[model samples]
Target: MSNESSPLQSSLLVSERMAFKLHRQGMIMETIGKNNAVCNEYPSPILPKERWRYQMVNMYPDSGQCHPFGRR
Candidate 1:
């Protein structure tokens, strides 16, 4: 039909951009728990509002924060 992305695709693109921006701003914490050497390590039992700042368990396969299967 048209050379335009569907609504779902547009939303996904926006989400990706936001995630990238957050990551660049250091607002997205990539690790948690004792293993990470960084000072800004995210809390293990992450609070509700703080949850958005941490990397998603399912997204980071090699992260020590949680297993790729989504278990911490």
Candidate 2:
């Protein structure tokens, strides 16, 4: 046994640093819906692409622009 961290540990540290950097650069982990609210409390678990799709489909119907979920 040696008193040194493994390569995997170092890699994990670097990854965490990069994630923080990206987040600080105004890059949200997920997208907000039409209501201008995030679905989940934590944006990390939410997917941006899926949220965008849902917003578009819900905001605009096939015929024209309408509120599918009902006006708030």
Candidate 3:
């Protein structure tokens, strides 16, 4: 009898544990822009204005909300 789990099983277990930990910590997931991109790196909540400026500049360029035009 093998006592080892398959790679997929291990990964699933890890993911489940991570989700449980996040839920227990009251860490809710959220998106920063219209693109619905996930952001979980920051432990603290960032201001919506700051996030909008950052995401807009990083994700969009032709919109003119960044660089020399917007200077944000």
TM-scores of all models?
0.41, 0.37, 0.35
lDDT of candidate 3 at residue 20, scale 0 to 100 = 51
Q: What are the per-residue Cα lDDT tens digits for candidate 1 across 19-51? A: 556666667564644655645554233222334
lDDT of each: 0.45, 0.41, 0.41
Q: What is the lDDT of residue 11 in candidate 3?
A: 47
Better candidate by TM-score, 2 or 3: 2
Flag regions of model 1 displaced more than 4 Å. 1-3, 32-72
Candidate 2 stretches greater than 4 Å from native: 1-4, 34-72
**lDDT tens per residue, model 2, 1-72:** 143277534544454455555656645554445567645433453222322211234433555442222121
Ranking by TM-score: 1, 2, 3
Local error of candidate 2 at residue 21 (angstroms): 0.5
- What shift in Å separates residue 59 of candidate 2 from its native position after superposition? 44
Superposition-based RMSD of candidate 3 using all C-alpha atoms, in angstroms: 16.1
Ranking by lDDT: 1, 2, 3
What's the lDDT of the predicted structure labeled candidate 3? 0.41
